[model samples]
Target: MKDFIKVMKALSDPNRVKVIKMLQQREMCVCEMQEALGIAQPTVSKHLKILEDAGLVQSRKEGLWVNYRLSGGGSPYAASLLGNLKHWIETDPEIIALREYIPGLQRELVRKKQASPAETQKKDSSAAQDAATERRETHD
Candidate 1:
């Protein structure tokens, strides 16, 4: 019953449950989730760790991004709960809003929005420098 308890604990947090609900639609990275949920990246990562520990979610590395999805293999308790979760509390207004928000989430745009001003400045300057170099090569 330890697995059962773990799954239950993972679902106890509203944010964690929301993460699961979003993953039910498609694979997502932390940045997209952070934007959709309006939560800090560290907090979102913490929730993901707990959900992974419970075997309710799995992750894979794609390039620099780690994407998460509902785990197909886990304790029987996890499978049962994940199956039932599809129909649970989905009618609530918040869940409906979240589902609506997922389609518009883009990781690149979300990360840019979250970047510090200095970081954004550095990127902008770097792009201008690269453009200058490209123009010099083209003229030479």
Candidate 2:
């Protein structure tokens, strides 16, 4: 009963449930989750903590980053819950609609990460030039 309660609590939040649903396809790091959800890093960590404590999610630390996924061999209750959740989601139209967004989300994150430092610097310089031009015009 305690385990059930904890699992239920962990899944009660829509964001956490979405996170789990996202992880259903593959393991993800915190930064990946942050990009996918478009939420703050701290908020993602908080939701992950609840899922981890409930034994529904497991994490492994590799050097500086932690990777998270659905626990395949944790408590029986958690495993069972995930299994049922998967089945339920597969049959739900609302969740099925998410398939279209997942690829875009993943691609956007990868594109952002792959942007060159020079590109960002160029943008910053352009913005500074624009600001200076505006200031000069105002003074004149």
Candidate 3:
């Protein structure tokens, strides 16, 4: 009963549920989840921790990345719940939208983004400024 309550509580959050759903598709790193959910890295970590504690998810080290995936054979309760979840609420519009983006999400891309986030933002800002300047000149 305690394990069940913990698992239920972990699944209570929509973000955590989304994390489980995302992991159903493929193993993901925290950075990949952050990009998919448009949330901060710390938040993703928190959700992962809760899920891990609940035995719904597990992580393993892969190089510099810790990849998270749905647990297969941990607690029977967790495994049963995970199996059911694969078919549950999958038709939700939010889930549909998330599914659309999952195929394009890659661990390497997330790593690259994290590696030079500031540089990427600077480049994006410069590009936007250049485009604005061009528009202004045209209007003038």
Candidate 4:
């Protein structure tokens, strides 16, 4: 009963609900969530802390960065709560707004993922092309 009340209390906040809905798509860093939700980092962290305390969110640290996602708790009650949240937010207008931010967020994530290979290749190519143009200009 006490756990149930805590879970309910966590879900009662609209910001927390939005954060959960966002997590349904992908794990996110606090910075990305701040951009998507148009909220300050501290506010996002607060919401995340509430969700974490309720067992609705799980987080892991990668070096200095911590990423958060929906927690797949072993408890049946926690699972049911997560399911209900999924169903409720999927149909809500606020959650729909989250969809608008998703594409940009996904693109950013992809860009980050692609950076290691893409960065050097792109910079080298650009430099080479600039050098070629300079050579051509001098020759002309």
Q: Who wins the lDDT comparison?
A: 1
Q: By the TM-score metric, which is better: model 1 or model 2?
A: 1
lDDT per residue for candidate 1 within 24-130, as digits (tens), equals 99999999999999999999999999999999999999999999999984899999999999999999898999999999888888888999999999999999999
Compared with the true structure, what per-residue lDDT tens digits does model 2 show for residues 75-135? 7778888998886667556456554566665534555675689997998899999999999
lDDT of 3 by residue, 1-140 (tens): 88888888998999999999999999998998999999988999999999999999999998887889998836787888899999999899989999999999877877777777788888899999999999999999
Using all chains and alpha carbons, the TM-scores for the candidates as numbered come to 0.90, 0.69, 0.79, 0.70
In order, candidate lDDTs are 0.94, 0.81, 0.90, 0.81
lDDT of 4 at 79: 72
Please say which candidate is ahead in TM-score: 2 or 4.
4
Q: Candidate 3: deviation at residue 112, Å?
A: 2.8
Q: What order do candidates take by lDDT, descending?
A: 1, 3, 4, 2
Please list the residue runs of candidate 3 whose C-alpha ends up more than 4 Å from where it truly belongs after superposition.
115-140
Task: Give the clashing residue pairs of candidate 3, or none.
Answer: none
lDDT of 3 at 116: 75
lDDT tens string, model 4, 22-129?
988888888788878888779999999988988889999987678899999525566797887777747677788887777677535644654667786898899999
Worst ten in a row by lDDT for model 4: 106-115
Stretch of 10 with least lDDT, candidate 2: 91-100
RMSD of each: 2.1, 7.5, 7.4, 6.4
The candidate maximizing TM-score is 1
Looking at model 1, residue 116 earns an lDDT score of 96
